[model samples]
Target: MNTFSIKPTICFDTGSIEYLKNIKNKRVCIVTDPFMIKSGAADKITNIFKANKVEYEIFSEIKPDPTVQTVAAGVNKMRTFKPDVIIALGGGSSIDATKSIILFTVKILNASGDEYKKPLFIAIPTTSGTGSEVTSFSVITMGTTKFPLVDDKIIPDIAIIDADFVKTVPPQITADTAMDVLTHAIEAYVSTNNSDYTDALAEKAIKIVFEYLIKAYENGEDLEAREKLHNASCMAGMAFTNASLGINHSIAHTLGGNFHIPHGRANSILLPYVIKYNANLESGEETEAGKRYAKLSKILGLPCSSISEGVKSIIVAIKILMKTTNIPMNLKEVNIDKNDFLNKLESMVNDALNDKCTATNPIKPSKEELTQLFQEIYGE
Candidate 1:
């Protein structure tokens, strides 16, 4: 039997930030990045706290691909603050770090047998990517590897998508994050665990990304595009959270952690290559993943003569989108040293093979296959 679930209560609209006002008379702890605080985005939520008379503390030290040390520090702060509500108010990094903080804090409290109040968790995504708001997955970097932690306890109680927060995002970040949404939707749709419920959500998210990502990237001020992309991200997140992800994410996580590439960019760079690999049929039989890709291409009104042709069409479309949005088409274009990449290929392959997301991948790649795939992505 397949199980499907939507865990978070989501609010998506033009001024959804106002929902924070409902959080009254509580001690709230907000986890965010320094950029969000400095850029005045955090103020949007803080002002609501002030109006609601909610005492709050801001932990704004979260970095991109937040580390275990950073999460530990945030957990320590959360323990001392004893907040009634914990809000994650930035991009995927901040939301993911906050999730780790809450998870570990609860573990610590439970181990000590101390009475603790479970804080109401809220995720307000400042970017339209990662769907970290609704998902139970958190990607935390430890040393040179990214550990994707998955647990229902880390899922937010509420997800607030306010397009206003994404309005000022730079074009490059907008492109990167939007690609991340596409990756999530595609991976979820083709995942071995996918069900009708997940396929529906994933298809809608994919359609929205294709329809609006370019508009949002071209004109950040387009609130309609921004809102649609924001909703797409959340929809994709919900789909993947239940359906799980695939090897595309697994490979991306490994590359991002080791090479210091942005998570979204890493995913975007590896996407086309992974798609081709997943759709490949040595026995000349259509795989489930290939058929899914064909279906997606048909849904998007792309060319579809056969499964292979449909898959090729989808790949071409993604490449065009990446180029139009200025995303690097290969790892080599991202300035990573070729020698270093080759040196680390074995380790990355191992980590990717063991990734939690790999279990749900439609095609289980051997280490040798993964190595070749990585090299191909590196343009070797």
Candidate 2:
């Protein structure tokens, strides 16, 4: 059986953060990184608590690629504070770490068969990326691998998407995350489990990225662009959470975990190559995925009179977008030494094949195919 559901009431537009006031007199705990503290975005949330006389605590220790260790620390904080509400107030790392912390807390607090009621979970994204605010997924790092955990309990109760919070985001981050939004939307649209519901949301997200990602990247203060991208990210999250992802995310998760590259940047670099492999234009074979790519190209107003041409057009368009956004086009550009990548190629292939995401790929890839795709994306 198949079903579609959009969780988390998405809140956006100017003054959306004002909803924090509705949180009442409950004790609130904010999970975020030091950057939010430095940027004063953290204050935006805390200020509301103060005005309403609500008690709160801060956990600003989150870092990029946050590990199980980081999550453990957050769990400790949650245990002591026992907050009535939990607010995740940073980028993907902060939100993901908070989700992990909450999950761990459930295990720890309920270890002796005691019922632990979850706090009111609220997410305020500081970037127009990840869509973590609305998804049941969370990536927690352990050693050299990142675990993508999906659970009903981790989905935020509310996602506040005020663009004012993201006005200070740097250009490169804007580029990286906006491309991530495109990947999420495209992957969801072509997912094996896709339906009319997911397709509608995915199409809207893809259209928004093609139209406004660059505008926001070029000018961070572009409020209209930021708002559009922010909403697009949420919509893409909704689509992917329902439809699931594919090898594009599988390979991305493997490589990003291995190389310590930022997740969104890794996805952006691999997209063009993955799209080609899925389309199978080189083998001159027609496929459902190829047809989907063709439809996407046509939607972008590219040259897509035929499936092959549509495939080529979509690839070219992605390359063009990557160049314009200054995203590295290959592993070399991201400074992944060829020797290191080659040395780990076999394991990465196995990991991608076994990745949870691979189950939903429109086309199942073999070890040889994945290896070749990895080599090809290594670039000149």
lDDT of 1 by residue, 307-349 (tens): 9989999999999999999999999999899989988999999
Residue 268, model 2: lDDT of 95
Candidate 2 vs. truth: CA RMSD? 1.0
| Candidate 1 overall lDDT versus native | 0.92
Candidate 2 per-residue C-alpha lDDT over 1-380 given as tens digits, one digit per residue, 9 for 90 to 100: 89988779878897899898788879899999998899788889888888999999999999999999999999999988888899999899999999989988978888958677798899998888799998988988888777889997899999999999888889999989999999999999999999999999999999999899889989888889999999999999999999999998898888878998888899999999899888887777899999999999998899988999998998898888899989999988988899999999998899899988999998899999899999998896
Model 2 spans > 4 angstroms off:
none
C-alpha RMSD by candidate, in order? 0.9, 1.0
Give residue 41's error in model 2 in angstroms.
0.7
Best by lDDT: 1
Going through the candidates in the order shown, the clash numbers are 0, 0
TM-score against truth, every candidate: 0.98, 0.98
